[model samples]
Target: MDTPIRMLENTDEATKQTLENVRKRKEKFDKFERYHNQSIWATIILTSIFLIYLYKTVFTVYSYSFAAMFSAFVNDSNNLTFLVCCVGMYGGMNLLKEKKDKAEKEYHDLRCEIVDRSKDYWKKEDEWKNRHLVFEVMKKQYDINLYHEKK
Candidate 1:
């Protein structure tokens, strides 16, 4: 089963090459998965902090007047944009991870195609060799007949 497709009865280069490619793709996909997971955790932490800060500044803080307190809260919101940007980057990185996963699936499917094509190629090669052998035998017979006629 492991040695299903080969040129003759010797080597399984097609399977070896396909397995190597699958290994490389799996490694690449795992690397991106790690990065994506880290980014997701970071984004969750940052968003939590942002929400807590917003709640404290908007509700807990007191001033002489509601207008003045609301103004202060609005002024402090300038840094919230940075947190938003961090979350956005995490989302973008997750999209990249999805693309890498799709590529890995494509590479995995290629293994089946490699085996099929290798079997087909070997079959054709054997047929070609048989035809050549028959042609050679016929040519020798014809040459012998010509020599006998000349004699």
Candidate 2:
């Protein structure tokens, strides 16, 4: 079957259309690339939030201030402040976990978009290259620069 590139090269008027198509393809490729970058930044932010919350809950909660506060609050081992802190930490952790999960989903979707846009861009680029080759042959045969020549 005759390809779009071959047809486009055969038609003199198609030069304008070809340039427009290339421009659109590049725009599409760039758009997906931008989304991919944004997704990565979102993932980083979500991951950082999760990590910081985890560290505070597990490690930083064992400081001297926390120990002294607990000792002063209650003589018994079970303290209201400790329970409230743990519960609050658990709720905050769950909230962060949900946000991270959503961010991960968005990241995956952006990756797919990038792949799709890349495939389309490369496909069009190949067609453009083939068209150029055809243009080269025509140029040599006719002794004219078909691309930039006056109509």
Candidate 3:
């Protein structure tokens, strides 16, 4: 059976090293979360503005073309093409939004995991420190006795 001192020493070294690694990962995760959120918001706003402009321009043109074609007793195929283009643009924007949402969710999950791991490592490190203090006191008392016995 290993003594308390030996066990404490072993745990102390391992915990300290793991704590450093956890701290680094926590920093990285936080940075990524911030960046991903910013990107998502920017994409949403830009896509909204683009869709509004596209609707205004395409609808106005289609309405004008349809009125002219009706008066002349002619069919307008150009209006159908414009409608298809508008629908395609809307579909593309929706796909991009979904992808961005997924990425943002992933970043959030990663950030939470890093925070939880960091907290666990800190708790273990504190426990190790307390045990090491007790071991040090015991070792000091033993050393003093040996020193006096030599006299």
The all-Cα superposition gives candidate 2 an RMSD in Å to the true structure of 14.5
TM-scores, one per candidate? 0.53, 0.35, 0.38
The clash count for each model shown is 0, 0, 0
**In candidate 2, what are the lDDT values of residues 72-105, reduced to their tens digit?**
4455343444455555655665555566555545
lDDT of 2: 0.48
Runs of candidate 2 exceeding 4 Å displacement: 1-11, 62-151
Evaluate residue 85 in candidate 3 and report its C-alpha lDDT on the 0 to 100 scale. 59
- The window of 10 residues in a row where model 2 has the poorest summed lDDT is 142-151
User: Tens digits of per-residue lDDT for model 3 on 56-87?
Assistant: 65555566676653543324454455456556
**Model 3 weakest lDDT span, ten residues long:** 142-151
Candidate 1 residue-wise lDDT, 1-151, digit = tens: 2222122232235534554454455566666777777777777787777767766766566546788667766677554585667669777777977977786566445534533454443355655455333223323432111111121
List where candidate 1 sits over 4 angstroms from the true fold: 1-11, 62-70, 111-151
Cα displacement (Å) at residue 13, model 1: 2.1
